[model samples]
Every structure is written in structure tokens, then in C-alpha cells.
Target: MEWLQPTSENLIEGYDEPQGKLDIDRVESKQITTNTIISDFFVMLNCLGERTVSQLPAPDDKVYHRIMEEIAPYFERILIIKINNQIIEVSLQHVKKEALTILNNKAVHPVLDEFFHGEADKSGYNLFGQVPNRSVYKVLPHFIDPLEDPEVQQLFDFLKEMCSVTKDFGFILKPWLLSDELKQLQAIRFAAHYCQDVYLWVDNDTERIFEIQFKF
Candidate 1:
């Protein structure tokens, strides 16, 4: 983390650890698998109905059954970590593929590209999430009480069992400006629309008010 003078783009002025660079693949291209995450912008690899046994590499039945009686069901995906001398990541797959395309193509964004696997957080060494309707939780939340849903409760137990195997693992999302502090900021304001260009309406608007929109 470092601090500097605020710019039009970054009003907050300071940043947290410039995010974790835990993998060379993420650095080169913010993609773990070459598969498509699709429009939902959710679900790690789009394994909508796939089970852990199908998605994960084969392990001993004794090891697998101990984790979950029949087979462990993921919220959608799992973070498989195998820790040795240093952390080793094993799971991060995007399940969906573009079937309509004549050419193999994929799409990504703030949503689909977003993976909250907190590999950097000590508590989140093996990231697990059950995000419903886009709500988020801490890297790790205490599951002290029994959940109402039997399947969900089972999933929680499954997550705990997975954590016991500390040897192996793995899994981000990104953002830019959100606010500004200047008094005149709101008075004379223009902000980008998400992934949309700030100067998008510049050439079209009669008032030309969008001229002040961000350029760089």
C-alpha cells in the first residue's frame, strides 16, 4: 500500500496492497481457464449443475467420503489448495463455453471476472463462498450456528472438512474510482458509467457538458 496526491481518476489517494499477484497466469491475462464465464458475471467457472467429483481431479474414495458422505456439492466452484514448501493452487475453473460462436470466443467483465477467492487472506487461504444475490461475506465467516437449509448446512460442514486438509489450495475482481472529496466535485461532475467510456456522449451532446469527462 502507498499514498499519493489525488488525481481526477483516483480521488481516495491511497490504495491497499496492489492486489495479490499469486499467479503468473492472472498477471498475464486475468483468466484462470480459457473457458467463458458468460453474462451472469457470477459463478466461478459456470459449473451450474456440476458436482465436485466431476469437476475436481480424482482423489482416494476414503479421503473424499470423509469430507462429504456421498459427494460434496459446491456452491458452484471450489478452491483446491495443496500447501507444501509454499502455497500451491489447484482449483479455479470456468465451466461455461460459448456454443453459439462459430469461432471460439469468450467474454469477461467486472462481474464474470470477479472471483472472491481470498488466497491472500490467511483466513481465506482456501476461499469458499455461498454468495446469493451478490451479497458478500468476509474472507472467512464463523459458521457457529446451524443453518436452516439442510443442504446449505451440509455445504458448511463440507467446507470445514475441506479446510482440515491444509496441504493444497487456490483464487479476484478489480475497480477504479468511486468518489471524490472536493466541494466542487459534485457541483461540476461527470463520472464514467462502469465499463462505459466517460466521453461516450461528448460528440453527441448538444450542451457539450460531457467535455469534462475523463480522457485517460
Candidate 2:
């Protein structure tokens, strides 16, 4: 089926915390009355969220692309349905489409993928749930002198671009996460079973999130 933009951006917004307001079971129940395909997609997302807790190694590019392609159409379709029903503002379409493009078009650069080295250490918390807190400083500690290495500089540039894009939206990218210098940053901090100190910093916050693993 063709991908329709989602009715609610919050439902399928990328790199966001799980919705507290949204009781997935309830939403599923209600949505099933209207569209089984959308309800099924919600179920899939919920399952994916649960599976995310395993702290698995990042999927290979091909695997990642396959997953995105498989899901993108559903997200788009859901958004379109929502808009048609007058459930949300029309402005949300741009945001949702941007997300869809990221999923469908963007591939994790080899350098960025190598940042994990292995199982991503799985040691930090932020808006994207328990996924890797992929700060360049944490991931590529060796490139302390980034300017000295052209390759590292290139990677930094890519990260900065990524940071700018994510920051423009309501999400925080690892590279642009709350930094000490960006004191104006607002963040959500909480404790999790695996990590004691977790922070969720959102858009336009000029702060950096320091990985707790390093302090210890």
C-alpha cells in the first residue's frame, strides 16, 4: 500500500520518547475500529520498542534500510489519515515527511556506524529511549584532536549537520546533545534500571549530554 502521512505526528515521530498519553493498547483498540492496517502498525512499533531494550548491536546498513523501507509506507499512510480526519494541524505533514525521508533515504555512514565499535555500550539515556547515546566524544575518544585528523574532521562535519537538523525539530541528536557551554539547554533527567543518570534534552537547547560512563 502507498505510504500515507500519519494522523498524529507523535505516534510515528522519529527519535522520541514513548508516549505517556498514548496508551498503546487503547489506541490500538480504538484504531482497529477504523483501520486494521494502522492498528497493526502500532502493534509493530510497540513490539519494536520492547525489543529495543535488548541493547543489540546496530544493524548493518542493508538491514537498517530494509526495516525502514518496510515501515515507512505505514507511517506515511497513518499521517495522511490523521490529517484527513482533521485530527492534527496540516503543518505536521512536513515534519512527518522529513522523518520518512530520513528513514527511506539516509544511510548511516560507515564512519558513523563504526562509532558503536560493538554493542554501542548501551550506557546512557535520552529522548530516543535506551538506544545508543552516540556522542562523537564518547564513541571516538581517540580523535580528541579532531582537527589533526582530516577523516575525523569530516566525520565531525557530518555530525554537526546531523545535529543541526535534529535540533531544528524537537529531538536532540547525540552530537548536539546538552553541552556544558550551552547552559540554556533544558533536559529531562531520570533513572533507569541499567543507567542511573539519564537526561532527555530537546530542540534548540545548546547543551551537551555527557555520557555518564566516562565519569566513573
Candidate 3:
């Protein structure tokens, strides 16, 4: 999924806080519902808000594509899903060592949390960059395309507002988790390309999320 900015130049329409976020329980089902997806996204945005998060401030075509290209090669771990399911501890072992050494751990963990545990660190590193308060970074446009349902749109609005209340600047590692079909684990390696503090995520498919152990 393209994490499109909610900028006027990009179709010009649309789109946080460090506070307690909403948590909805997962209802077991092989086929995920739209509401479930919406809730998962809401939690992701709220997680971004609760910390000093970073996102791409609507990057121009060149930078976005280049960064994506650079990120493409980082995902090489063949996650035998059925096999990995039994492992209790989830680590960045799946992520390439060089990327982790380059971008460092801070830039990648949040994205990992979203993909694996379906949560974020409410109390992780608070080191923010030199972004001025109320800069363009604070404005996060909707990442996904406009949906057809009014209820879903309203929920999305709630997500937009959630980010508005936080100290979020454009420095996040975007993972294309808009659908279950996307290779989400591979997609999240997008974090490895950047060497700064970044935060990002999208609606999840609720793949029976497991417990996540904190490194810090």
C-alpha cells in the first residue's frame, strides 16, 4: 500500500498524542472484517502519537521511490510462518544485520512491534529530532485511499485526529500493511533504509498476534 501523504499536491484532500490509546480485543475469524482493520489502524496511529514519532513529510517522487528501492533488498529472511509460530520470543533476527547497524535499533523497532505484536512501546525512547513544533511534520494526511463506507471514513477521521494531538513529525518507516495479502514482514523493512527516528504502520490482518519482548 502506498503511504500517500494527505497533501493537496497529491490529491489535496485529507488527512496524535502521548496518551493512553484505545485497545480492542481480537475476535477470531479466518476472514477479517473492515471494522477489525479499522481498529488495528487506530491503535497504530495512537501508538505513533503516544511517543516522539517520525514520518516522511510527504516526500517528493524521487526521494520516496529511491528510499523504497533501497529498502527493497533488506528483507531476505524466509519466515516459515508455521515454523516461526512456535517461537516464543520475536527478535530483529529477521531483519538484516547491516540495516540494523546502519539505521540502528531506534528507527526499526516500532514498525516491528506493529507487524508482530500488533502494539507499540508506550514507554520507549523519547529522543525526538530537531523538528519545530507545529511544523509540516505534524500534519499527517491519510495514507490509504478514501474508503466507500461512511462509518469507515469516520473512523479514519478519528485516526487523523489522533496524530494531530501528538509530537509526530514526518520520520516514520512505512510498512504496506493495507491488506493481509501484502508481505507485511518484508514490507516493514522499509524502516531499515532511513537512519533516523521514524514511526509508521497501517491496518493489520490480525494474524493471531503474539507477545512481544522489549529489548530496552
Going through the candidates in order, what is the number of backbone clashes in each? 13, 17, 14
- lDDT against the true structure, per candidate, is 0.26, 0.26, 0.28
TM-score of each: 0.23, 0.21, 0.19
lDDT of 3 by residue, 5-33 (tens): 22222211233221343332221212211
What local lDDT does model 1 show for residue 5?
22
Tens digit per residue, CA lDDT, model 2, 1-216: 011111212222344422333211101101112222222222232232222211111123442232233333333222211212222111111113333344345453333322221132243434354433232222222211122434434433322332232322112233333333222221111011112212232233323332222110
Question: What is the Å distance of residue 165 in model 3 from its true position?
Answer: 24
How far residue 135's Cα lies from its native spot in candidate 1, in Å, is 19
TM-score-sorted candidate list, best first: 1, 2, 3
lDDT tens digits by residue: candidate 1, 19-107: 34353222111222222222122243333223422223223344443322222222223444332322333343333343223112444
lDDT of 1 at 67: 23
